[model samples]
Target: MIRGDDGIRAFFAGLARDWRGWRGVRKWDTIEHDLAIKARHTGRKIRLNFTLRPGSDRDYWIVTLEMVIPPDESLDRLARDIGELFGDL
Candidate 1:
C-alpha cells in the first residue's frame, strides 16, 4: 500500500503517464463524455480527479478513480490495465 505525500504524488503521476497511451475505439455509449468536460485543466495538463476514503475496517482504504478519457479510449481496456496494476483487489 502507498503511504506518505510522495507516494500519493507518484501514484497520480503514474496514472498521468498511462493516460497518454490510452488509445483505440470504444462504443459511444460506453465513453464517459462528461468526465472530459469535468477534467481539471491547468496549462497543458489535464488532471483526473479521485478520492481516497477510509474503509469500514481500519486495514483498508477505498480509492475512487475519476477518469477523463477521450472518445476513442476503450473502457474495457482501461479496466484491464487497472486490474493488472492493482491485481485482484
Candidate 2:
C-alpha cells in the first residue's frame, strides 16, 4: 500500500473486487517472491507494488506502478514476485 495516494487503491479495485485483492487468493509462493500490491484504473490501470526489505527501515519500501498493457511482461514478473511475498499482510 503506497501512502499519500488513494488513487492506487481506487484503481486496482476496478480490475478486481476488494475481497479478492484482500484475500490474495492466488498462490505465488510456488516461486520465490515478497511484495504487496494494490492496483486500479485511472486513465489506465496501475499496479503499485511494495517490497519491504529487511535490516533497513530507512529503505524499507519500494514501489512500482506501471501502466496497463496487453503484453505487460515486466509488470507481470514484478507483480508476481511481490504478490508471492508480501501481499498486503
Candidate 3:
C-alpha cells in the first residue's frame, strides 16, 4: 500500500492543463505507463487504466491526472478528487 495519501495528493495537486497520452486518465492530470501504451490508448477521451481518453483528432483539451498512484500523497484534497475522476472513468 502507498504511504500517506497526502504525499500522493501533493504530487499531482497543482497540475495545470493536462494532455492526453497513451493512457486514458480520468483525473485529466498525468499517468505514466510506457508498457501499456498501445493496449490502452483507444481514442475515447478516457481509458480503463485510469486516464483521460484520447481522440482521433486533438480537439478537446484534456487535463491528465497523470498517475493512479500519485507520487505525492500530502495533498489529500487533490488525491480525493483524482480518485473520483478515476471512478468516473
Badly placed stretches (over 4 Å) of model 1 are 1-49, 55-66
- Model 2 superposed RMSD (Cα): 11.2
Order of all candidates by lDDT, from best down to worst?
1, 2, 3
Cα RMSD (angstroms) for every candidate in the order listed:
12.9, 11.2, 14.0
> Tens digit of lDDT per residue, candidate 1, span 3-88?
22323333434444555543322211102222111234343344455544443353465555656654224533554564456453
Cα lDDT tens digits for candidate 3, 1-89? 23234333433333312223344333322333211211123343322233344444344544343333222333345546856654433
| Candidate 3 lDDT for residue 80 | 66
Best by lDDT: 1
* TM-score of candidate 3 on Cα atoms, chains taken together: 0.22
Better of 1 and 3 by lDDT: 1
Off by over 4 Å in 2: 1-34, 55-67, 70-89
Candidate 1 RMSD to the real structure: 12.9
Clash count of each predicted structure: 0, 7, 34
Candidate 2 lDDT at 43 equals: 32
Task: Please report how far candidate 1 places residue 85 from its true position, in Å.
Answer: 2.4
